[model samples]
Target: MNFLIRLLVTALAAMVTAYILPGVNIKDFTSALILALVLAILNLLVKPILVLLTLPATILTLGLFLLVINAVIILLAARLVKGFSVDGFFWALIFSVVLTVVSSIMHSIAGGNND
Candidate 1:
């Protein structure tokens, strides 16, 4: 299914992030899979509400605040998923950014939706 493919891509992205970002540590493939699942769920279930709540700030910041929101979401996912560690807020921010970029590139190359 497409959902499973997306999850796999996300897990791959997490692994790539762990390799590239020093502060993001994924203990194993299992941890990467878990982190990817949590991130996908958070993006689906929580991100819209957050975007709505932060609409004013998002507008003020010209959409830059979404990066902060994404970092916070990644931090939350790190907390929820075992064996996946994000060193600190700054690390989480960097991890989130790298993951986003890598995932986007992979998705596009794979001819998948960015959802």
Candidate 2:
């Protein structure tokens, strides 16, 4: 139940991100939900391994490299999900940032935990 609420909030955030970010395109509610689910799964499963693998670079970059890794993950999600598209590399980066911000705000407003 909590997870379902979080997922719905995430999907809403994705839809909002798509509305605000020109480069990010989510065709419909279903696409937005799918994209949000995929993104959450990727962040949960793949991002930790990626963070560990790039720990040195992340340290060297003073944690800034995490942004690049996030962008890459968002690009991967966009590629994996149909009807959810990011225009280009630059767009993917911007969309990633927007998505993160929107999701964070939504989660906080909904009293969801970061965990």
Candidate 3:
């Protein structure tokens, strides 16, 4: 299913982040899967509301403030998912970018939906 594929892609991305970023830590693929699931749920249910609330700062920063929001989300996910942790907001921001790049590649390979 598409959801499963997305989760796998996310897990893969998490692994890559851990490998490439020193401050990021993902225990294993299973933990990565759980982290991915938690992140997906948060992004689905929480991210929009956060974006709405931070719209003024986002606009003022020309959208860069969204990165901070993303780091916050990552920190929240880290707290929820054991064995997957980011050392600080600095690492979270880097991990966010790395995850985005890796997931984009995986999604393309899986023919993911843009919608």
User: Each candidate: what lDDT?
Assistant: 0.90, 0.88, 0.92
TM-score of each: 0.92, 0.91, 0.94
lDDT of 3 by residue, 42-85 (tens): 99999999999999999999999999989999999999999998
Model 1 residue runs over 4 Å out of place are 113-115
lDDT score for residue 101 of model 1: 91
Candidate order, TM-score descending: 3, 1, 2
What is the Cα-based TM-score of model 2? 0.91
Which 10 consecutive positions of candidate 2 have the poorest summed lDDT?
A: 106-115
Q: Which candidate is the best by TM-score?
A: 3
Which lDDT tens digits does candidate 2 get at residues 19-45? 998888999999988987898899999
Error of 1 at 69 (Å): 0.4
Report the CA-based lDDT of candidate 3 relative to the real structure. Answer: 0.92
Judged by TM-score relative to the true structure, which candidate is superior, 2 or 3? 3
- Ten contiguous residues with the weakest lDDT in model 1: 106-115
How would you order the candidates by lDDT, starting with the best?
3, 1, 2
The candidate scoring highest on lDDT is: 3
Alpha-carbon deviation at 28 in model 1, angstroms: 0.6
